[model samples]
Target: MFARLIRPLGLCLILALPALVFRLSGIESDPLILLAVFGTGVVSASFVLAWAAEAAQVDISGGLAIAILAVIAVLPEYAVDLYFAFTAGSRPEYVAYAAANMTGSNRLLLGLGWSLVVLIALAVAKRRTGKSIRALTLDSGHRVELGFLAIASVIAFAIPVSAQIHVALGVGLLAFFGFYLWKVSRGDTEEPDLVGPAATIGALPRRQRRVLVVSLFIGSALVILACAEPFADALIETGAQLGIDEFLLVQWLAPLASEAPEFIIAILFALRGNGAAAIGMLISAKVNQWTLLVGSLPVAYLLGGGGVALHLDGRQVEEFLLTATQTLLGIAALLALRFPRWAAWTLLGLFAVQFVFPGQEARYVLSGVYAALALGAFVYHRRHLLPTLAAPFQDHPDEQAAKAAEQESRTAP
Candidate 1:
């Protein structure tokens, strides 16, 4: 009994440590130490959040459960970026950090997170099923997510054109997210296939399971609320102290810290030969980040007394354009409900080029390249694109297959 309790207890301790330390020591004066403490807290809370989400599937429909999970999984990212956006209201210098963090997190999800999922899945598929995975095939039901993403991506271009995130934009995006949740909530429910610590907690008696899940959710939320401000502020201070470009640090480092847990969890799922679930979760997350996450920024700014819009400067404009273009390319690549290896590599390659040639000229040039490629893909796949966009409203074979897969996993010993 003691041995069985160890793993779950360890996870609880891991989830608790950072919050305990933060309460005891408060924010450290040393930026590096502060970063380490709060960052670790965020990562640990992320794990708890992930497990709680999976456990939730036992009680909710698969699509809605995953959607909720995606939102919760990204809470850390939201906390950090929203902090920057809200802070930017009064301190205009902080405006760039808000945009930097948002664009970087969005780009990283596709460039690093999506690509890594396919690569890892391919490797796992070969070993487990003796089948070569040329591409990661998404269920047709994902069309709902991809279609919504396409609409948002197109609207995102308007932000750069206007050089501001207006309240109207926020309203539109939030409306889409609300519709997305409603659509997904009506999807078929399946018994959840729990794994790892989630499985352990889920095996408990019903009342006990419910208690644990609620505890995990409340605990992780508190940890995030306690740590997000310190972590965000420490990152900026650390970059300043190290003489690192604050924009670059906010763009890459902050996201790397906040997004690490999700990346690791998704990769782990792929490695276990559950590539579909891994990619699906990431897809849902992308939608959440693009819609609710982006939409909430201007609202935060407004609440912080920054007026009705969040204004962007030149660099932020370019960043938004680049991020939006990349999103278009990603949707085109997955229009057929497939993520080909070549498409994955293309995303990673283009993302890397930005780091190599960091200038206004390069940003525009790369944006053009992405847009051209996306247009070509859309034109070539025009026939499938319409059907795909209509998929959420119709029954699909892929949805059935996904349901069957879930049933099998859930019943497995």
Candidate 2:
């Protein structure tokens, strides 16, 4: 009974956290907070259920999970955009905020999270099994995904600064989204196939699965958003207390907290030796943030008003540079293409260095230098790195199919 009740009760608390935060903040009971909470729960539930379904080898599309996650992830940004669109000067501030959040998040997934996973695996496996890390060979399917993410990141980074230019960028992002979906539909020959519908719904009756699908979808989203609000509020309040920037609070700390769910799921996937699924999910997240999130912001701004206009002060510029530098370091590590125990330690070192240092021009400059060194190391190791590390997980085709079959068989009975 407790097992059955925990998720629901946990979800309830998630829904209530924002209201609790507002109460603590001395703000009056606000309907927006409640609504946001509800939306967050619904979205989070959807993401969770879809993930469960996918893990069970159900026929339900994992794309739905990504889509729901993206939508809910952007809700706060959406709310802010609405506020700035009508009430504020220079409507473009909304777009700029969205860009920061999206780009920052995407880079975190790519440059940091991606490398961390492989590095951890290599280190732990080597320590335990006494084998060197092998190269992750990419078949056609993953090649496509890698290509897609790289292209999207480049495009998102290239969006011109002018408000007028942003409009075109939005349209381009939309087009890319459509093209991506179409490519997915065509199906990559090398990709593992999704679970069939019958198998997916077998665990629940048809009607029950339908209800579960809807409830889980909406409920998950609500929980995620609800949790996000309190999480954000707490971080902001704490950042103020600690004399840290709100941007750092949100970009790094809040995400570390709120995104725990996704990471937990990914870790589970990795532990199961479903490295492809783990990599796929991470890659999907980065691509979605880079293209879908960044792409849609300008469009959202334009619909709300003329367009978003944002100006970065020296402080913000320093922060962005720090983030970008860290990202470049991670990227350099990634381009080395081979996983090594040392790389993990190096990344941990870089991550640690940033936190220990005070917020000053000198500290940021040091960060930039570290990032540059990582990039240089990547270039130095290119021959050994690029060919070896690109795809760290590749089961033989027949073996992979056998694993899938075994997964289906266990789930079916």
Candidate 3:
């Protein structure tokens, strides 16, 4: 009883902390104070969101559950970036900041976030399995995510070439995301392997469990929506007050706050030896950002009355190209449904190159490098590519059928 109450009580306190701070200080207080208060709230909300997602696995297929979790986890990033895009309509100067925030968040997830999860998984695997683990092997069912991500990557490369995002592009991306959700929803359900607060909630009787899930979802969503704007605005204001580059602050600091909770949740999953789910959640997140988040930007701009299209200046163009290429490289690395240690390090090293050489030439060079690596990987895994692409449209199969297919692929000459 005590152990059960501990996690629930702690989660409730975390969820209340930000609201308490906000009520006491108000949004009109110091920028730094607002940042601290709202930021803390977003983090607490993330914990509840994560546990809720884990518990939801009992009601949904693992794939669909992670996909839904990915959507929720990225809500903060969407909140911050969308705010920038929408505000950019009235203040054209904010256009670049919007692009900066989007590109920075995407790169950060693949670079730092993905790499950290992989490393943590490797460490945990070594301890539990009594053998070194070089890579994280994903279930074949994840082909649905990888395939859709690949398609989205191909479409994203066109954004830089076009120099603007049109409403048509937004529709296309949203359509793709909708199709993905529909496909995943039909997946076979499995018994949820729960932990922490999620396990506590999952153990309840049906009615009680559902009530807790609904309560958690509503509570966390409300907290995030309430705090996200203030937290984002405070970051920009604090940057100006401190003489920091506002664009850099929006690009990095804002994402750090919005993304920190998801990162911690993934790390927790990794530490528990559930590396596949951890990586899968992040991969699903990448797809969401690449599609829905990117798609919604132009819509937000238009809703703000910016123009018929959202234009990308030279810097923003470079950022988009770099982000798209990085995504391509990441998808290619996971072509075989495996994320290797060397690949993780390579991603981090390339990401680190930006800070070391912050020049236009470096940006172009990195983009070319990523594109080349991606091409090489796609070519090497050409044999497996077609099947992966077909996975989403293929009929759902039972475990035995999936295993048979896996065996056939391996045994083929």
Candidate 4:
């Protein structure tokens, strides 16, 4: 039993070996080489982080477990981006990298992450049922996530409008996260259907399970923290040498590396035909990224350097606008609690095009398109709009959920 568990755990540690060595030995390498080594570390450690997060379900409120897991799973991203935010205090140029990292992760999670999960789930469902699953339907407990995301999306626009990430806004976002956690903590505890290594760890005795979870969180966080600065710098240096745009590289590649675990885990869930769990996990991640991860940037900046806010340049502003709109569209698409095939493909399509035409004008057009679609979706699913936004704050969420379920069944064809 010990050996069986050790195999998977050791595999992840081995994958992260190069980063650990580089950090400790202070090895110097080419920019691309550093990128490869450090990026591998981020990706590998993130897998460990995700497993630890999943195993943590055994220790937390069942309804809130996924959200907490979502938060912990993306800590690699927070480490890397926050490093940039902290550095920006002295090196002002790093401010863009910080914003870029945040926006990229949020966009990648929602646009690519959410869509691919639904697409894979649909394919698997079709294979089993001989009929296409039109959409992935979420459980009522997810209403809290949607409501929090809805509020975050609206507030996110202020970043671009004000052209900065100010302390006050950070406070507001943090407050939202705090309230979200508090609300979720009150939910009834249920046994989670964990799989793979998470299942292995979760099956351990309570005391051992917690100790291991804490150890993994600490170990992976140390690995991520050690690699974060070097990885961010290597990305920029490598981009310059290759004549690729550094901002774009920071915007995309860094996120791709940091969010790899989340994408892989969510994909696995979809492959198991559990699209709702997969999508719900990513949605919760979005809420975390938009609120907690992002909200911490200015704080990190202030602690690293004396700054009241982090200023956003033109490009950063555009990225924030695009990210915010994509988030709103995601919320609107999920308003009816069903992520339809068309919406999946539509989001995937839009996400792809953003890279194909990376320009200010193109960005504005894309943002407008997202807003237009989101507005239309809210109108089309008008009845669900109010309920979704109000779901998190109800005095009796379980009873409300029951009523909603009853109503849904009555309206079912």
Best by TM-score: 4
User: Which candidate leads in lDDT?
Assistant: 4
Cα lDDT of model 1 overall?
A: 0.82
Clashes of each: 0, 33, 0, 0
lDDT measured at residue 227 in model 3 versus the true structure, 0 to 100: 77
What are the per-residue Cα lDDT tens digits for candidate 1 across 182-293?
8788776656666777777777777777887898888888888788888888889889899988898889987887788788778888888888778877888888888899
Worst 10 residues of 2 by lDDT: 388-397
Q: How close is candidate 3 to the true structure, as a TM-score?
A: 0.89
The reply for model 4, stretches above 4 Å from the true place, is 62-66, 205-208, 397-413
TM-score of 4: 0.94
- Model 4 lDDT, full chain set: 0.87
- For model 3 the local lDDT of residue 180 reads 86
C-alpha TM-scores of all predictions: 0.90, 0.66, 0.89, 0.94
Mark the regions of model 1 whose C-alpha exceeds 4 Å error after superposition: 1-5, 8-19, 23-28, 129-131, 391-413
* Error in Å for residue 372 of model 3: 1.8
Q: How far is candidate 3 from the true structure (C-alpha RMSD, Å)?
A: 3.3
Candidates 1 and 4, the one with greater TM-score: 4
Residue-by-residue lDDT tens digits, candidate 4, 1-413: 44567988898899899998998999999999999999999988888898888889888765556566777788888888998899999899999889988988889888999999999999999999999678888887787789889988899899999999998899889988988888878766667768788889989989988999999999998899899989999999999999999988998899998888788888988898888988988888888988898889999899888489999999899999999988888998987788999999999999999989999999999999999999998887666777777877885554555565567667768
Clashing residue pairs found in predicted model 4: none
What are the lDDT figures for the candidates, one per model?
Answer: 0.82, 0.49, 0.81, 0.87
Give the per-residue lDDT digits (tens) of candidate 3, residues 169-192.
Answer: 988998888888888877655566
